[model samples]
Structure formats: structure tokens, C-alpha cells
Target chain A: MKKKLNLRKATPWLSAIGLFVLWELVVRIFNIPPYVLPTPSESIIVGWQFHEAIWMHAYHTLYTTLAGFAIAVVFGVVLGALVGSSRAIYDAANPLLVGFNSVPKVALVPVLVMWFGIGTVPAIITAFLISFFPIVVNVATGLATLEPELRDVLRSLGATRRDILIKVGFPRAMPYFFASLKVAITLAFVGSVISETVASNVGVGYLMLSASSKFNMPLVFAGLLVIAVMGIAMYEIFNVIERRSTKWANRGNPTN
Target chain B: MSNSFVELNDVKLRYSEGDDLALETTNMKIDKGEFIAVVGPSGCGKSSLLKLVSGLMPPSEGSVIVDGKEVAGPLKIVGMAFQNPTLLPWRTTLDNVLLPMEIVKPHRHRLRKYRAEYEERARKLLATVGLEGHEDKYPWELSGGMQQRASLCRSLIHEPELLMLDEPFGALDAFTREELWDILQNLWMIKPFTVILVTHDLREAAYLADTIYVMSKRPGKILVERENTLVRPRDQETTFTQPFTDLVHELRSHIRDVRES
Candidate 1:
């Protein structure tokens, strides 16, 4: 088990380094202009050189993404529960959810900017719109697909509605919730970046736009790197928290 | 002592407001401390009978009287185990066993005040089922047989007046199923609760039940009721003996007859 885990841990880093090495080799071999795609080392150096200013921009994007993600989570979970527990609500709202989900959230950026006037609000709204659907869809599906036999077992045990929700429904929903969170976190980052690109002047998306306008490709690459790092870091944090809380679920599965 | 601990009088059940009867005109009466096994072909409503007796479901057209009162809703005095262990995966084995206490009233009202006592009761129930050292383990951590044992422990933890088994050991391997039958026998021997076991296994019914009820398919109704005639503390050894196999075969033939009819 220990050896397997060690190998599992090593594989990702090995793949990442290999990819980086390939990128650098390809760039040097082709004599590609730095403006087009900076060399791996050049991007890393740029990332370091602009660390302070980049942190500020990244922080702005992070806050908007996080705030939007939080709001969406709250709305999605409550609405999901409402819809999930009722077939009528589910039927009524599911099509709307799909419709909204398919309406590329990026297209809403200009509309949001028009409504919210080029501030953090538009970025946050964009993130909320982009990231909300998965949480809703995942949670609603999870709640709907609850094992009937399990429900009967608890009901027979004299568990009230509240008890069933707290004990069975909620915990059962966690895996799905976390699954949605994984999708949501990445989408949250995308939403923030998209919004900043279109509207905001103070985020990693803005930094990328500013760098592109000036043709500072290294700075743009650095911004992209920071976004990637942030997305990965958020996902890891969520995975760790899920692991700690649901240690029971991790028992039999080696991969968990 | 009560003459009939449980009585189901002309019970009828349907899934919805206008649906045809799922179970029809079923009548049953069980004595105190009686271990009754209900066997039937699939969809025979053997489980539905247990549900009615346990007050998990109200008979649509009959009075389900337990301890002489019409069963209105889920009865607190009943414990149940299913084909699947259904142990909440998040809870430790011990905690899963104590779940009823935390949710069911009388115990729920006092659980926070007497938590240690409840924990001890849970531990004792687990130990009785040969799961002493595994109290802290999660459901997924345990093997199939072990999880089923824990599930049984959970059912019995609240010390209900009635114990309901709905094909509880059906999912287990034959050896493990036999082992559980004995474990269950010993537990009932120690403190006999009015047991209503639902199973597809005729052998299990013959072995565990003092009285075995057989039912027919779909809109299920009682086909036969046979008294075991076998003696108490019947162990695994008895299962292979001529007398027991004869009883099991008799029940099997009855089931076959019901299905054919």
C-alpha cells in the first residue's frame, strides 16, 4: 500500500516535469518567439519577478471567484434540495437548469457589465452563473437517486424527516457535492478570468489582457501559470477536507 | 402475558391512492416471544407483511394491531435488519448501532443526558454479535458477513420488543448465513423478542421459526402456516439432520406449490 501510494504521488510530478521539459525543448528547437509562448524557464522567472503585483491581481480574481462560488453553492444546494425532494419541482426546474447551463456564461459578461458597470460585481456574477449549474445538477441528482431501501430502513427506525435529512440524505450527498465542487472550483476560476478579461481592471484576467495589449508574453504566461496553480491548489484543499471528513468512505478503496 | 403479541386482521395494501392491491386480505396472529419466519416467492409481499407488523406500513384495508393497539405509524418497539446491512457508511459500527437511540424518542430525549449508558448498551449489543473488537471500524472496512452482523447488532441495540428481519442474511454466503442463523438463535434464546423474519430461503425459515408462514406471488396472500415441531436452541448441527431437512423440504414444496398455483 505504501509503495503504491509513493508511486501514485510520484506519477503526477513526473508527468508535469516531463511536460515542462518537452515544452522547453520544443520551444528551443523551433526558435519560437517568446511573445508567442515563453520558454518554461522564462515563464517561471517572469512569475517570480512579478510576484508581488501578480499576487494582488490574483487575489482580486480569487476573491471574486470564491465569493461567487460560495453564493452559487448556497443557492444551488438549497434549490437542489427543494427540487430534488419534490418530483414536481424537479420536473418544472430541470429544463430551465439545462437551458441556463447551456447558455455560455461568457456571453453574459457584456450584459453583466452593462448591468453592474465594470466592477467586481460583474466578475462575481459571471463566476456565479458559470459555476452554479454543476453544484445544482450534482446535488439534485444525488438527492433524487437516494436508495429507497436505505430510506425505508431509517424510516422504520422511527427517524423523523429532519433526522433522515441530517443523518442519511446530507452525508449521502457529500460525495456528489465534492464531485460538483471539483467541477465548480475549476469553473469558478474560469468564470473569474473571463469576467476580468471582459470587464474588470484588477484581476489576473486583467493582467493577462494588459500583458497581451503590451505584447509582454512572459507576463501573460505568468498570469496563466498563477491561475493554473490557484485552481490546482483549491482542488487539493477541497480533496484534503473531503478526505478528512469522510474517512469512512476512504476505508475500502485504495484510490480514495 | 399477551395472547397475541401481533395481529394483522384482513390486511390489504396498495402503493397509491387508486392502485390495485399489492397485498390482499392477509391475516396473521403471532404469540409473544414467537420466532415466525415468512417465506414466499419474489414479490410475494413477505416483506410487506413484516412492514405491517413492524408498523413501517399501515395496511390500507385492515387493522394492524400490535400489543392490542392499531399500528398508526412506525413502532418504536420494533427493530429491523434488511438484506443489505445499510449501516450508514459515515458512522462507526458502534455509532451505527446507537443510531436508533439518537433518533427514536424516549431514548432520543435522554441520549444526551445518558450518552455513556447508551454507548455501553451499543458496545454490549455489538459484542453479543461477535463484533467486540470491531466497534470503531466503518461499514466499508468490514467484510459482507461482518457488516451484516453489525447491522443485526444495530437492529437489536435499542432492545425493542419486536425484531424484524427482511432477508437480512440473503446477501451473505451460505456458511456465513448459517453462522448468523445460529447467532440469532442464541440471542433470541437469551432474551426472546417477537421475531418476524422475511426470507426466500425455506431452510432458514424452517430452522429459525417456531411457526413458518408461506405466501403466494404478487397480490400476495397467505398460502400456509406450518408449526416447526422442532425444539428450542436449534443449532447448525440440527440443520443437516434428517428432521430439519425434512421440514425445510416440506416448506420448499409448499412454496413451489404456491408459485405453481
Candidate 2:
């Protein structure tokens, strides 16, 4: 079992290294130009050379993504609880939320830029808009699907509605809420990048756009790599929190 | 009737308008501290009787009186357990047992002030159910029998006057079920709360209940009420005796009649 766990831990890194080697070989064999398709090594070199600039842009992107995600968390929890509390609120708001969610957030970046005018605000709003829906949907589902038997137990105890909500509903919704955060954090990055590419003057998205315009393809690739790493890191953080806080939910499924 | 602790008078329950009645013209009178069990076929509304008596659901017609007062809504004086232990997955066994005191007042009002006292009561109840060392464990970590034992602790912790059990031991193995009967019997002997147990098991009904009620198929109504004459402090050895077997057989005949009809 220990050997298997060690192997599992090593597999992802080994596969990533092998992929980079293959990419390097393929580029070298094809004699691809740096401007068109830089080798993995070339991209790494360029990434290292531009580390200072990349770090600044990465920081801006991170802040905007986190700010938007934080807002999404607050709004999603409150709205999800309200909608989940009754069938009437769910019925009244569900269609509007679905319609709003269906509209691609990419299209809204321009309108946001027009209003907020090419800064962190548009990127933040874009991230908020894209990520909040999943949190709301998951949290609402968690609250809504509370077992009828459990509800009956509380109700028969002369527990008030507020008592049931606080004691059972909210705690039950937590696992779902954490699950949504993992999904939403990735989407939050997507939203921020989209706005950065279209409207913002700073961020990894803007850096990539600017680098690609100058035919610095290796730098652009490095920006993409940075964004991917950041996304994975945030996702891992939430995953750890989810596992720790809601271990009981996963007791039956120990393999997770 | 005036002396009855829980009185159901011509109770009729329809879940919704234009729907068939779940229970029709059901009348029952249970004395205080009586261990009453309702047994019937599936979907026979045996559970509906327990619900009405607990005031979890109001009767569509007529009234339910408990302790000389009409039941308007859910009563604080009742403790309930179902076939599924239904302990919250998040809470430890001790905390799950203490859940009633966290909600049902005057305990709810005093919970913060008397946390240690309540925790001690919870621990004692868990000890009674053979769950002393398992108090800190989560519900999922425990076996079904252990979880059900903890659930029983949860139900009785608040010390409610009325205990409502709906097939509480139906999901357990025979040995576990029999063991729980002894545990329940001891608890009842010690505290003497009024109990309304609904089950399909005739032997269980005969073993635990003072009065065994047989319900007809839906829309259900009481068909027979048999007073158990088997001696008190009943155990597995007593179950082998002729009188206990006779009581079970007699209840079985009533159920067979109801099923055939």
C-alpha cells in the first residue's frame, strides 16, 4: 500500500516531464522557429528571463480572481440559502438565473469595460459573473435535497424553521458548498483572463496578448503555463479544505 | 377516556384535497406509561396513527388529545425514532444524542448555561445503550445496530413523556432486534414514558407492547386491540414460554384476518 501511494504521487510529475521531453524533441525534429513553435526548453528559458514581469502580472491576475471569487462565495451562499429555503423562491428565481448564466460572460466583458473602463473592476466583475452560478446551484441543491426523514425528526422535536436551517440545512450544505468552490475557482480564473485579454491593461492574460503581438511565442507559452499552475494550486487548496472539513460525507467512499 | 394519556377520537387524515384518506375514523386511547404497538401490513397507515398521536400531523377531522389538552401542532413532549437511525453524519454520537436538547425547550434555552450537565446526561444515556466508548465516533463509523442504539439515546435524552417509534428495530438483524427489545424494556421500566411503537413484527409487538393494535389495510382503521398478558421483565427465555407464543399467535391471527379482508 505504501509503495502504491508513492507510485501514485510520482506518476503525475513523471508524465509531465515526459510530455515536455516529447514536445522538445518534436520541435527540434521539425526545425520549428522560436517565433512559431518554441521548444519546451526555449519556453522555460524565456519564462525564467521574464520572471520579474511575469510575477507582477501573475500577482495582478491572482488578486482579481480571488476578489471576484470571494464575492461569489458570499453572494452564492446567501442567495442559495434563500432560494433553497422554499419552493416559491426557487420557482421565482430559477429561470432568471438560468437565462443569465446562459449568456456567455465573454460577451459581457465589453459592456463591463464600457462601464468600468479598462481596469481591474471589469476583470473582477467578469470573474464574479462566471463563477457565482455553480456555487449557487450546488449550495441550493445541498439545502433543497435534505432527507425528508431527517427533516421530520427535527420538525417533530418542535424545532423552529430557523433552528432546522442552522442546525441541519446549513451544515448539510457545506460539503456541496466546498465542492462548488473547487469548480468555481477555476472558472474565476477563466473569467479574469477573458476580461484581461479583452479589456484590462494588466494580468497574465494581457501579458500573453502583448507577448504574442511581439511574436514572443515562448513568453506567451510561459504565461499560459503560469495561469495553469495558479489554477491547479487554488483547486488543490479548496480540495484539501473540502476533504478535511467534510470527511464524514466521504466515509463510505474511502478511495476519494 | 378521561384517564387516558393520549386520546384519538374519530381521527380522519387525508394528505391532500380530493385524495383518499390515509386513515379513516381511527380512535385509540392509551394510558400513561403504556407500551402500545401498532402492527399491520405494508401501507396500512400504522405509521399514520403514531404521527397523529405525536402531533406531527394534525387530523383532518376530529381531534387528538394528549394529557387532557388538544394537540394543535407538533408536541415538545414526544421523542421519535424510525427504522433508519437517521443520526446526522456530521455530528459525533454524543452530539447526535444531545441534538434534542439543542432544539426542544426549556432545554434549548438552558443548553448554553448547562452544557456540562446535558453532556453528562447524554453520556449516561449512551452508557445505558452500550455506547459508552463510541460516543466520540461519527454515525457512519458505527454499525447499524450501534447507530440505532445511539438514535435511541437521542430520542430518550430529552426525557420526553411520549416516545414514538416507527419500525425502529425493523432494519436490524434478529439478534440485534432482540437485544434492543431488552434495552428498550429496561429503559421503559426505569422511566415509564408512554410509548407508541409501529411495526409489522408480531413477535416484537408481543414482546414489547402492553397493548397490541392490529390495523387494517388503507385507508386504515383499527381492527383489533389485544392486551398482552405475558409477565413483566420479559426476556428471551420468557419468549419461549407458552403464554408469550400464544399472545404472538393470537396477534398473528388478527393480522392474517386483516390481510385477508
Candidate 3:
């Protein structure tokens, strides 16, 4: 088991190192044009030169992503719990939720910008739109699929509805909630960047847009690298939280 | 008999708006501190009877009186365990057992002040079920039988006046099932709470119950009730004896009638 876990933990970093080495070797061997794909070293140099400026933009996108992600989690969980507990309510509202999900989240960016303007509000709203559905859908499924016998057991013990919700329903939904968080975190960053690209004066998305227009491929590559790093960092943080919250997975049984 | 602890008079139950009744005019009176087993065919309303007794549902056409009061809703003194043993995965075995104390009223009001006492009680209960060393372990860490044992401890931790077991050992292997039977027998022998066990296992019914009630299918009704003259603290050795097999075979023949009819 220890060996299995070590392999699982080591594989990602090993693959990443291998990919970087291959990229560097290919670039040096073929003398590929930097415009097509900047060599890893060239991109790193560019990334380091404007590190402070890149961080300022990175922080803006990060803040917006966080604010939107937090709002979506809170609202989605509460709403999901309500919808999940009642089949009638779920059937009534499912079409509306699905329809909202179908409409391109980017299309909402203009309307959000028009309403909230070109500040953090519009960007945060965009992130919320993109990240909210997964949480709501996953949590609703988790809440709905609780075993009937389990509910009967609680009922026989005279557990109140609130008691079941807090003690059984919410904790039962944690695995689903964490799975959704993995998807939501990446989408949140993407949504923030997209919003910034369309309607912002600051953020990594704006930096990428400006660099591309000026044909500064190296700077564009730098912005892309920063976005990648941020997404990975956020994913790692959430993965840690998921591991701690769900050590029950270690025993390979989810009886509850 | 007149001072029955639980009484159900002509109880009729149905599942849906227009379906036939699940239980039909079933009458029963249980004395306080008596242990009863209910056995029946598949799709019979044995479970429905338990539901009525626990006040999870009201009988369609009868009155259920527990301790001389009409059961308007769920009673706080009822504790239940089932075959699958659903303990919350997030909590330790000890926490899961103490869950009722966290919610049930008098205990709920005093839980914070009485945390240490509750823990001790939970520990003692787990120890009774042979789960003492596993207090800190989560439900997933334990095997199926171990988890069920922990679930039993959880059900009894609140010291409820009535204990309900809904096929609690149905999922276990024969050896484990018999082991739990002895454990359960010892627990009841010590406390003497009123017990209502719903099961398909005739031997289990014969081994554990003071009285066994048989029910018919669909719109289920009690067909017969037999008093077991078996002595207390029955061991595995007793199950091999003539009286035990005779009692089990009798219950089995009644279930055959229930199935065919």
C-alpha cells in the first residue's frame, strides 16, 4: 500500500519533468522558431523578467476567482440541499438549471459587464457562472442517492429532518462536493481570465491579450505559464483539503 | 397482560393512496422487558409493523399505544439498527455510537456538560459489542461484521427503553450471525429492554425471542404467536438441542404457510 501510494504521488511530477526535458531537447535539436513555441528557458527568462508585474495581474485574477468560487460553493450547496431533499422541487427547477448551464457562460460576460462594469464584479460573476453548476449538480446527486435503509434507520431513532441533514446528508455529500471542487477550481480560473480578456484593464488575461496584439510571443508564453501555475496550485490546495476530509476513502468503504 | 407495555389494536397499514392494505387487523400486546421476534415471508409487512411501533408511520386503520399513550409521532426512547449497519463514514466508531446522545432531547441539552460521561458510556457499549479497541476507527476501517456490531452499540448507546432490530444480522455469514446473536442475547439479558426483532432467520428467532410472532404476506397480518420456553442466556450449544430445532422448524412451517397463502 505504501509502495502504491508512493508511485501514485511520484508519477505526476516525473511525467512533468520528462515533458519539460523533451520540450527543451526538441527545441535545441530542431532550432524551432520561438514565435511558434518559445523554448522552456526563453519562456522562463521572460517569466522572471516581468515576475512582479505578472504577479499583480495574477493576484487580480486570483482574487476574482476566489470571491466567485466562494459565493458559488455557499449558494450551490444550500440550494442543492434544498433541491436534493425534495423531488418535487428538484423536478421543477432542474430544467431551469440545465438551461442556464447550456447557454454559453461567455455570452453572459457582456450582460454582466454591462450590469456590473469592467471591474472585479464582472469577472467574479463570470467565474461564479462557470463554476456553480458542477457543485449544484454533484451535491444534489449525492444528497439524493443516500441509501433508503440508512434513512429508515435514522427515522426509527426519531432523528429530526435537521438532524439528518446535518449528521447524515451533508457529510454524505462531502465526496461529491470535493469532486466538483476539482472541476470548479480550474473553471473558475478560466472564467476569470476570459472575463478579464473581454472587459478588464488588469489581470493575466489582459496581459496575454496585449502581448498577442503586439506580437510579443515570449510575453504571451509567460502569461500562459503563469495561468498554468496558478491553476495547478489551486488544484493542489483543494486536493489536500479533499484528502483530509475524506480519509474514509483509505479503507475502500463508503458505507454511509 | 392488561398492563401491556405496547399495544396495537386491529392495526391496518397500507403503502399508497389506492393500494391494498399492507397489514390487516393485526393485534398485539407486548409486556415491558419482554423480547419478541417477528418472522414472515418476503414482501410481508413485518417491517411495516416495526415502522408503526416506532411511530415512523401511523397505521391506516388502528391505534398504536406505547406505555398507555397513543403514538402520535416518533418516540425518543426507541433505538433502531438494520442489516446494512449505516454508520456515518466521517465519524469514528465512538462518535457514531454517541450520535443519538447528540440529538435526543434530554441528552442533547446536557451533551456539552456531559461529554466525558457520554464518551464513557459509548466506550462501554462498544466494549460490550467487542468493538472497544476500534473506538477511534472510522466505519470504513472496520469489516462488515465489525461495522454492524458498532452499529448495534450505536443503537443501544442512548439506553432507549425499546430496541428495534430490522434483520440486523441478515447480511452476515452464519458464524458471524450466531456470534452477534450471543452478543445481543447477553446485552438484553443484562438490561431487559423491550425488543422487537424482524427477521427471516427461524433459528435466530427461536434462539433469541421470548415470544415469536408470524405474519402473512402483502396486506400482512399476524397468523400466530408462540411462547418460547427456552431458558435465558441460551448458548450455541442449545441451538443443537431438540427444543431449539423443534421451535425453529415450527416457525419455518408457519413461514411456508405464509409464503403459499
Candidate 4:
């Protein structure tokens, strides 16, 4: 079992390395210009040379994304509870929220920039706007779909609505909340990057945009790599938290 | 006037205005500490009766009087268990059992002050249902039968005057169901409480109840009330007896008649 597990874990890295080698061979054989599509080795060299700059930019993206994600968590939970608790609030707000969610978040960046000015503020706002919807939807679904039998049990015990929500609904939503966090974290990064590319002077997104305009293809690829790594790291952190917090939800599933 | 512990006077329940009645003009008078079982076909509102008595829902037209007072809302004196164990998956067996105590009061207010005492009671209840060592185990770790047993402990934890069970053993296997029957009976024997059990199983009704009320198909009304004459301290041996079989047969026929009509 241990050997199999180790082999399973190694598979992805092996495929990734193989893909990079193939890309390098294709670039070298085609005699591709470094400005058009840099070889994997060239990209690595460029990334190493610009490590300090990349780290600084990555830090800005990370903090802005986190700031937005933190706001999303608080606002999502509150709005989710409100929507889930009452049919009136759900009916009233649902269509408006749907319409808002339908609008391309990229279009909203210019408007956000106009209102908040440039730099991290618009990026953070964009991140908060884009990532919060999934959390709200998942949390609301969790509370709304609470087992009727369980509700009846609590109701028969003379538990008030507040009592029921606090005791059962909130805990029931924890799994959904955690699940959404993993998805939302990725989206938060997308939001921050989009805003950064359009309006920001710093961050990995800005680094990529500036590099590409100057035909620094290798540096642009390096920026992409940094964003992907940060996104993966955040997602993994939430996944770990989710597993610990909602272990019971995953009990019957063999994958856990 | 008979001092009935729970009285349903011309009780009728309809989901909405002009909707078909779920229960129609049902009248029942349960004596204090009596174990009553209600059996009927699917969608016959056997559950509605339990809900009315437990004050989860008020009768549309008529009154549900428990302990000589009309029930206007959910009663704190009642504890309930359903077909699904409905134990919170996140909670341990002990914590699930203590859930009611944390909600219903004067116990709720006293929970913090008498935390140890409440926990002790919860532990004892778990032990009664053979869940002593499993107190700290989450619900999903336990089997279906074990979860149901813990559910029973939860219902009784608050020491409510009334217990409402809606097909509480319907999902368990035959052996597990029979085991729960004995456990439930022993609990009632030790501390008598008014029990209103709604089930489809005729044998279960005969084995556990003092009186079995058979209800008609949808828009349910009581079609028959058969008093169980089996000797006291009923057990697995009693279930095998001729009298027990006869009682079950009689209840089955009444259900059949209700179904046909």
C-alpha cells in the first residue's frame, strides 16, 4: 500500500517533467525564437535570474488575493445565512445575485478601477466580488437542504429557529463552506490577476503583462508559473482544513 | 371527565387552505405513561398524529390538548425520534444525546451550571442503550442500529414526559429491530413515559404497545383500537407465543381492511 501510494504521488510530477522535456525538444527542433516561445531551459534561467523581482510581485498578489478572500468569507457567510434562513430574502435577492454573477467579472474591473483607483485596491475589490458568489451559493445550499427529518426532531424538542440555525444549520454548512473555499481561492486568484493585468503596477499579473508587452516571453512564462504555484498552495491549504473539519462528511467515501 | 394525558379533540390537519386533509377529525385520548402505537398505510397521516401531539404542527381546526392544556406551539415536554436516526454526524454519541438538554429548558439554562450532572445522565442513557464506550465516537463511525440506539438515548435525555417515535426501527434489519424493541421496552419499564409510536410493522405494535390504533388510508382517522392483552414483561419468548401472533394477525387484518377501503 505504501509503495502504491508513493507511485501514485510520483505520477503527476513525472508527467509534468515529461511534458516540459517534450516542449523543450519541440522548441529546439523548430528553432523557435525566444521572443515567440522560449524553451523550458530558457524560461528556467530567466525565472532564476528574476527570482527576487518575481518573489516581491508574488507577495503583492498573495496579500491582495488573501485580503479579498477574507472579505468574501465574512460577507458570504452572513449573506448565505440570511438567504438560507428565510424564503422572503432568498426570493428577493436570488434573481439580482444571479444577474450580478452573470456579468463578466473582467468587464467590472474598469468600473472598479474608476471607483477605487488603481493598484491593489481594485484588485482586492475584484477578488472579493468574483470569489464570494460560490461561497454564498454553497453555504445557502447547505443550510437550505438541511434534512427535514432532522429539523422536525429539533422542532419537536421546542428548539427555536435561532437555536436550530446555530446548532444544526451552521455546522451542517461547514463542509459546504470548506468545499467552496477551495474553489473560491482559485477564483480569487483569477480576480486579482485580471485586475492586476488591467490596472495594477505590481504583482505577478502585472509582471506578466509588462514582460509580454516587451516580448520577454520567458519572464511572462515565469510569472504564469508563480501564479499557478500560489494558487495550488492556497487550494491545498483549504483542502487540508476541509479534510480535518469535515471528516465525518467524507467517512463513507474511500478517497478520503 | 377522564384525566387523559394527551387528548386530540376532533383533530384535523390540512397542509393549506382548500388542500386535502392529511388527518380528519381524529379523536384520541392517551392515558399518562401509556405506550400507544399507530399503524396505517403509506400517506395515511399516521405521522400527522405524532406531529400534532408533539406540537410540531398544530391541527388545522381542532385542538390538541396535552396535560389538560391546548398545544399552541411546540411542546418542551416532548422528545422525538424518526425512521432515520437523525443524529448529527459531527457530534459524538454523548454530545448527540446531550443535544436536547442544551436546547430545552429549564435544562438549557441549567446546562452550564449542571454540566457534569447533565453529562452523567447522558452517559447513563448511552449505557442503557449499549453505547457506553462509544460515547466519543461520531455517528458515521457507528452502524445504523447503533445510531438508532444513540437517537433513542437523545430523545430520552431530557427526560420528557412524552416520547414520539415515527417508524424508529423501520430502517434496521430484523435482528437489530428486535434488539431495539427490547431496549425500548426496558427503558419504558424502568421509567414510564407517554409513548406514541407510529409504525407499519404489526408485530412491532403488538409486542411494544399497550394499545394499537389502526388508522384509515389518507385523510386518516382511527379505524380500530385494539388493546394488547399479552402478559407483562414481554420479551422474545412472548413474541413467539400464539397470543402474540393472534394480536399481530388482528392488527394486520384491520390494516388490510383500511387499505381496501
On the 0 to 100 scale, the lDDT of residue B161 in model 1 is 87
Question: What DockQ does each prediction reach against the true complex?
Answer: 0.56, 0.72, 0.52, 0.77
Q: Which runs of model 3 end up more than 4 angstroms from their true locations?
A: A1-10, A20-41, A252-256
Candidate 1 lDDT score at position A129: 88
Question: How does model 3 score by TM-score?
Answer: 0.91
The native-contact fractions of the candidates, in order shown, are 0.72, 0.76, 0.59, 0.87
Question: Considering DockQ, where higher is better, how would the candidates rank from best to worst?
Answer: 4, 2, 1, 3
TM-score order of candidates, best first? 4, 2, 1, 3
Pairs in steric clash, model 4? none
Error of 2 at B74 (Å): 1.4
**Predicted structure 2, TM vs. truth:** 0.96
User: What digit string (tens of lDDT, one per residue) describes model 2 on residues A10-32?
Assistant: 99899999999999998999898
Task: State the lDDT of candidate 1 residue by residue for A141-204, as single tens digits.
Answer: 8788877777776787788777887787878888788878888989999998999998988999
C-alpha lDDT values of all predictions: 0.87, 0.92, 0.88, 0.92
lDDT of 2 by residue, B113-199 (tens): 989999999999989889989999999889999999998998899888999999999999999999999999999998899999999
Q: All candidates: CA RMSD in angstroms? A: 2.7, 1.7, 3.1, 1.6
Chain B alone vs. reference chain B, TM-score for every model: 0.95, 0.98, 0.98, 0.98
The sequence of per-residue lDDT tens digits that candidate 3 reaches over residues A1-256 is 7797788789999998898889989988998888877788788898789889899999998999999999899988987998888899899989999999999888988999889889788899999889999999989998998888777767766788888888888888988999899899899998899999999999999989988898777889889888998899999898878878877754554321
- Candidate 1 vs candidate 3: the DockQ winner is 1
The 10-residue segment with the lowest total lDDT in model 2 chain A: A247-256
Tens digit per residue, CA lDDT, model 4, B104-210: 97899999999999999899888888888999999988999999999999889988899999999999999999989999999999989999999999999999999
Stretches of candidate 2 exceeding 4 Å from the true structure = A30-36, A252-256
